[model samples]
Target: MSSFDETQDFVVVGSGGGSMCAALVMRSAGKSVLILEKTDLIGGTTARSGGVMWIPNNPFMKAAGVPDSLEQASTYLDHVVGDHNDTPGASRARRRAYLIQGPRMLDFLIGKGLKFSRIAQWPDYYDEAPGSSVPGRTVVADLFDVNRLGDAKSLLRPNFLNLPAPLEDVMKLPHVKKSWAAKKALARMGVRALVAKVTGKKYVTAGAALQGQMFLAARTAGVDLRVNSAVSQLIVEDDAVTGVVTEKDGKPWRIGARLGVLVNAGGFALNQQMRDQYIPGSSTKHTSVIESDTGEMILEMTRAGAALAQMDATIGSPLSLPPGGEEWPIKPGAQNVAAAPHAILVDQSGVRYLNEGGSYTEFCQRMVERDKEVPALPSYVVFDSDAMASTMIAGTLPGARKPDPWYEQGYLKKADTIDALAGLLAIDPAVLRKTVDRFNGFVAANKDDDFKRGARAYDRWLGDPFHKPSETLGTIGKAPFYAIPVIPGDVGTMGGVVTDEQARVLREDGSPIARLYATGVSTASVMGRTSPGSGVNIGPSFVWGFVAANHALTVAG
Candidate 1:
């Protein structure tokens, strides 16, 4: 089983969008590269993601005649994230670097083979917050022909669980697409899928569309992918990363890197122990991370003297299913469309704790605080049947198949009175009833007096487009009441080993872990504090991958 592999120029750990893109970028530069993935699948969290990218002031926008500038993007970033360097100076630096390079990195990808179809109508997450751009900043990869990566197929996994409908279909809805081109693209995908499937063709997921394209780009350039390869630890010599000692197919394998190893193995959202240590109250609710994301690679690097930042922060929205429901226990998995209603997210005390329309990370932070302030993480989403009917739950789509990981798995309780629903959730029944009554008055008035939810541009973007009086304001006053016990669920954790702006992993003392690089969720997310816009997660991932690859090629690692 001893493969005894020779030294590679660059070794990348994890197959998420970041790892794949970085590997491709390196390979394109004629650098010797080896990508190691823990799972047999190549796509990590990337395959299960929305796959859109927010590359502000990108050339693609300019090509499409969309008006935007770097200055405007910087203004937007300042307005949304500000200069919150709470986690030492690392957080602020990472944020600034990401924002500055996000556009350039995206342009580099376009120069490669990656194509971006503009989601022209998709607004910045905080369009109204400050200097946000309108139309065309968010871009998705053109649907890929996964068949291009022949042998890579066995190494890649598609997201068949979480998102029930194809992203192409979902974005085609009236509220989503404000342009004719997007509508046409949606139609084309439908026609193509039907034609391709009838001819016994394999389908490509949105996550796959982005990652597979990167994989194919790398492979075409002769990049090496080492599957079933697990990095045991970093080979740190003289306070710098020289190489990595890994196990391949059950045998010790050491790969010397002249440049460095990029630890993009992703965060520990899927690791229960790490979740408990970092996000205590939400230890059990993170549902969107890949199973390989145990943070083992991160822990190994930490042991080799890497510094972790924002370790305590996690990101997730609220959701729940029925008791004894296999799928409802986690947050990212359970699609509680209840938030579309005027229902408020409440603590066990039955009091609202956060702006219902805030980003997932902010919500999780508040949920953790609320849980600590009260008792447990049994936060509830209080709504009624009317809201339930019109809202679109994440996993409960119309015609998707069974063995659905997020199917009807949590309590979908209903009661004639608000008090009864509160009783089911074990909340202070009187307080719960009163909160609902107050929320109802606001809904009737069509305004969010407390949080001013729909009052913001980002909230309105994800709000009910049909509800005219107030896109994000609705009441639970209609007949049968509902209360789904929500838990703090995360798509994944977004921090890891420190790295420089070039995506090179760095030591605790601000020294480079030579030839070592990290990107995606494996690095402190480039999006700083709150999630700025749609695709914030994947945009920087692709950009960093490009940077790391180019840097490695030039460094002789």
Candidate 2:
């Protein structure tokens, strides 16, 4: 038997959103806990993301009078992601577990001194479905001052966006050019930044805020948190995971977990070999997750007899990579390419397909599925001068404000007439013209009979809210028309080691591996393949992490 170098009542691998939740659970039970992070930084991809958790019936939603219930959430899930054989992680038992416990997790975090609020009116993707929450159920962490962490702040992972304002206020700033209220919000953000600077406080929003607060709580509770201590392998003892072999000072350091090991490490979205094997035609270059998500922990768990499911599944996001967008973490994210009131997407054949304003994951999945028949990998985001005048595309300013490289590199194509635009795009002039005319007809009737673009409340939120009669409906007939190439992208892959309702790693034979647990993207997603809402990927990650710690404590006792 291997000698144990050190031991804790509980051990958590990977500093993801749920990592601290589990550690905190152990701490609350008066047991010692240790968190081992592979990278030098604390907070995994959770810090780099938006940090919103799609927790149904969260306290914030109830406080705001937004109606949400476990039953209702289950009904919505039934419609968006019904029972499926392939995604065993999203079994009815686990799905029910997540919904019931999500609120409890939120309450637990709050009791631990973390603050959270919701994105009010961030509707469910399928509002047309029965029991859908029209006002949304996502809960976001309040802006946290990184300076509060002192020297530990430098060890925390950075968020993708540096906005000092709250997320809700930040969401409104995009409309600053058109709305006075938006401009006022922008001014407020400026004031907040100034206050933060003068007060010697450094504020971080989105994922960073959530992770920072969790880190702070864990530290206050005296839980051991270490970085650069990469867990190379899970130490199993007679079919039960009891510890881990992490590299310390360039040597293997075997740390024993007296209770269990919880692996919240991310998934394999960036592993090109795995991408090819599981989801072919997908590229790592297009993913939005941190490069550290290589799925090694998953392999370690598999070697320990854990079963895997939903390997072919990912949280797909439709993205438009501008010519120079490769320079940043967030590429040209035109998930709603045709979602603006005046724009639409077209394939190489100049035909408009699927509604663009629904779920971003679905949008990209449809893109990948459509690519089989028509060349749609580089589908074009088509809009006219009116669209340029009204709003930005893929968060970039329109018209002359765009960089010269956009046109020079052909990433952005333009033409003075529909015929000339067709010539530029190499599509038949008649097909382009006919597609535009048909879309214009839908706009005129204030109806989208073809794909029903504006049929859902969530879809309308993607469009110009100020637009009359319809938020997402507008004529695309005006020339000179513009187009930008969009590709399917994702925040991260959402599949790995399968876990049961209690968040225990399960073997292929349908039995739980004693004391072994997993959460975050390291486990097969609880929501399965379909992304039900904005934070479906994250909500389950936190809930199961909390559940794992409680269950492990019981077993340890």
Q: Each candidate's lDDT (Cα)?
A: 0.68, 0.88
Cα lDDT tens digits, model 2, 150-184, are 98999989998799987888878767887897898
Q: Any runs in candidate 1 off by more than 4 Å, and if so which? A: 1-5, 88-93, 134-136, 161-168, 172-190, 198-200, 323-336, 397-410, 427-430
Candidate 2 regions with alpha-carbon error over 4 angstroms: none
What lDDT, from 0 to 1, does candidate 2 have?
Answer: 0.88
TM-score for each model: 0.88, 0.98
The top-ranked prediction according to TM-score is 2
- What is the C-alpha lDDT profile of model 1 across 1-557, one tens digit per residue? 22336788778877777776777666666678888877778877887677778888777688889888867777787777776654432455565666677777776677786766776577776767666875748877766667677756766677542322346566545333344654666676668778877775565657777777777777777878767777787777776677778786678777777767777787787788887787665554446666787888888877876777777655565555344343543333332253475566778788876677746667666777776678537677777666665555444432212233333453555678888877777777899878878887887887778877776665665666666677677877776776666766677776676677777766777887666677777766666546777777778777787778777777764
RMSD of candidate 1 to the truth, in angstroms, is 4.2
Model 2 quality (TM-score): 0.98
Candidate that would win on lDDT: 2
User: Model 2 Cα RMSD, Å?
Assistant: 1.2
